[model samples]
Target: MDEQSTRFETNAGVVAQIRQLPVGVVLASGPFNYPLNECYTTFIPALITGNTVIVRIPRNGAAPHFPTLELFKKHFPSGSISILSGSGREIMTPLMEDGRIDFLAFIGRSSSANALVKYHPAVHRLHTILQMDAKDCAIVLKDSDVEFAAAQCVTGAFSFNGQRCTALKMIWVHESIAPQFVQKVCEIVDAFKVGMPWEEGVQITPVCESGKPAELKDLLEDAIKHGAHILNAQGGRFSKSLASPTVIGPISQHAKLWTHEQFGPIMPITSFSDLSEPLDWLAQNHFGLQSAVFGYDPQELATVVDTMAFQVGRVNVNAPDKRGPDTLPFGGKKDSGMGVMNAKEAVREFTLETVIATTVNDPRNVKALQGLEGVSRVVKGTAGIKSE
Candidate 1:
């Protein structure tokens, strides 16, 4: 436990000492898209904060971690870190029902997250860090750079086959620039190199999740049935796991694609005559993770930022919605997710702040407490100590 303590006099005669302590046991579960990185984001923090961890290896990406079992055992005490395989319901249900887990770190669907939390015997006592579903949007204004916006949208919507929860699932362009924006997006997506991941310069590759290709096809077909068009040349071409990058546009509000997250290489586009259209859509939407707005006009961009600030966790101005640099806080709002996760926030999330205090007149007690290692003295009576 990296302990930092501060002593300060409160109300002239009383002294208070505060520090952080571990939150007991953490049960972490990551998603298939970023199995190792996502799991470690929680594991490293929980372990460093002196909590025992039990990892539920994702069904799709379980092979990669098998070799690292010895590495964890080598660094940590016996049973400090345990990796479990096989059925999630079989293993995780008993753990949650046992009421031993203090923190739940989950990066997956909201439904699964809800189910897992419900299984816990003490729901109120469980601290959850969830990264769930998102239908993130990108808005392009009339005054924006059409080419740049289109390129960013293509990258944001299709990167990792749009598997990321932060990926832009929908795009809205101003009516005046919709045609140009859609054309540019299609051209860029069509030019992408599609092949195996090991192939050189492959921008799109096979999806890992089973039935993902068919699921994307169903969404595309449903959108088409409801008056949407497949704008790209080779869009909607699916062969087993290899589904080509697709762009379906002028999508109807009634279309399933408007509400459901494809989680694949399908870009859904819409046009708006008034700015209120997108704003109102966002206000009514269930998921609010992030949104991207591209324009040159300061007032127009400011309006977007201000309106979306309340609706989503992040608002990207003239850029694609992404989670990177690992320093900034990342998570979602509404049904998208519950808690924030990052370098600093992760540590704070898995730990608890505790205080030890005594009267200043008790010199023996103060001396004994201050003598402890890792204690920092902050005099002149401040109530709280900022985390380092």
Candidate 2:
């Protein structure tokens, strides 16, 4: 068996604690985007905690996580782990309704989560860890180093084909440096080789072939229709791949891309006169997965750290758009996630708590009598006063 499929030997102490808890079968479900890594994150943790699991792999309009299923069968005991295929209804509904599944761990849409809560209310054992959606932002202060800032923004907004939830969908740039930053970012993105995933250092890959590009095209058209300008459009079509790394300039709130999770290679740049506007927008948004702040000013840096409006799982300080410091929790506020999930956090999520107390004697024990000394003194004083 592969290292991930086996029990996590390193977390033996934590595993011992979890084993003491009452855990039953769990249902793990999510899209099949990054099969090996994503499924490993959920399935391995669930199984290691002594909870048998039913893993529902994403369809992805393809083969439905065959590779991951094979891995599960190879490593897990019979009935300890089972694989389910198909969309949510055909697979998840029955699995969730089953009385055996004590909990459900999911990474999908908010609507789906609502339905689970409504239909399976009696599954009090239900525990959900979701990575719903996000309009993740990158705030660039005027003090940022211009060239380095451009490189970071380009990588964040475009890498992994903009498929990651942490990807920088919208960029908030101070007006003073907006023009130069936009030009430089566009230059870097334009020079990127958009090709097959196997190509040498290819930065951008296809999102989907059928109609995803048209959907993105419509979104861009809508932005332009409502007064947003395209800053960079230098990209080539490689067969059916959606490889274009399109970036827009200074989009208004009215634009759809500004308020939604693009989930593709579409970067919208929004200029901020001050941090207040972006903070206002962040507060009102439903999703809060991650945000990147680029600044050198100590005051501005402290403001980002202290701001309640930007409440999220992880906040990057002038770093690349990526998950950080494995020890840190990876989740979000309002709609990004239900609970934390990772390392020690993951084990805790799939566990139960029980407390046991043992005492040698009853309430009349010597220690208990000593505890009543203060009250006894008050009673004696009251009696003596009455007698006097």
Candidate 3:
């Protein structure tokens, strides 16, 4: 991914030539979140690397409008890229168990990921790429632009009803600016629009699935019980039932929302006297996807980058929930997922590396190799005594 080595490399008088050889047939399947664009993360890259792709479109609860499927059908050849449509387990299990499907790329819940790999261990030996849950952290420093940072946090936390894995679920503000920052966040929350997505350009839609709203509700209640103050829509700290685009004040360590990945517009803010406190807190969470830090000092920001270099997949500076260009490697660490799905990385993931070598130790000018093994021999005139 760093482009350090792609074509050839030589070290210690040994030349190692590499080629990208595609995996025979790949099965790319996932949920409807970013349904079209996310599928391309795996499908297109696999295709570009010469692997035939079979995409399984989500056909159940909250299944998105598959415009890409139609586009594929109209233009591409029948067998070049196949599209499968059906309910979840019934259709997926058979394809997963099939031996011919060499590579698997899945995006869904952690439990479903286990089902895909665990059940068909004997048959499905391929290492599956998974993109699952995350509750990302947003660190706001005292020197940072508080209002700008809060605006970015609001968009990141509430957009898509906060369903995105990169959404800012937890916000850690410097203790010096905690009061002002919380007040501003509540002001924006009050102005947030909540209704049907198609009506009046509503900002906060319902949770993608049926049960998720209730789950978010329960988590909010638990956070409140644990001493987190919920800021009502009018920018007042009045205890009430939680709903869409609700903002919560600084919570303790024991709050459920602090740990759980809430797939709805529930924003939780915390204050820290020292930066290391929140950084350590973030490290313990098994799900490491993406995080953001807001600060003006270049040295401090560089330190943050250095600390999070291997901690998360990507780090956003002042921008909130900003996914870079399609060419950028978009992925997560640990429980968040495995392997990046950008064009270059996906191509690498779907393709196998092959090595070709030669040895000058052989006395004979030409030697016989395995008849059936597919190794070839070619001759050429050389001026030097050894084939160096």
Best by TM-score: 1
lDDT of 3 by residue, 1-388 (tens): 3232232343554434455577778888767767767766668878777788888777643245365668777877778798777776887788777767788788877778778776564644575678888878888988999999988999988888787878899999999998888888888888877677699868866555666667777887888889977775642221232345788866777888878888777889989998788788778877888999998898878877777667789888898865668689888897888888775677688877666444434423213212212443321112222323
Q: In model 2, what is the error at residue 20, expressed in angstroms?
A: 4.2
- Consecutive 10-residue window with the lowest summed lDDT within model 2: 379-388
TM-score, structure 3 vs. true: 0.83
Q: Could you tell me which 10 consecutive residues in candidate 1 have the lowest summed lDDT?
A: 379-388
Stretches of candidate 2 off by over 4 Å are 1-20, 61-71, 121-125, 235-243, 308-310, 362-388
With a 3 Å backbone cut-off (N, CA, C), the pairs that clash in candidate 3 are: none
Kindly list the per-residue Cα lDDT of model 1 for residues 1-388, writing each as its tens digit: 2434444435666666566678899999888898788878868889987899999988888888877888998888998999987677888889999999999998888888899999998999999888889999999999999999999999999999889988899999999999999999999999999998899999999999778998899999999999999999989898989999999988899899888988989999999999999999998889989999999899998899999999998999999999877899987899887888888888888888777666766667556545543354322223342211
The best-first sequence of candidates by lDDT reads 1, 3, 2
lDDT of 1 at 108: 81
Pick by lDDT: 2 or 3, better one: 3
Task: State which candidate has the highest lDDT.
Answer: 1
Clashing residue pairs for model 1: none
lDDT of 2 by residue, 234-283 (tens): 73233464748888867878889878787888889989897898877777
Once superposed on the true structure, which residue ranges of model 3 sit more than 4 Å away at CA? 1-17, 60-78, 122-125, 234-243, 356-388
- State residue 184's C-alpha deviation in candidate 1, in Å: 1.0
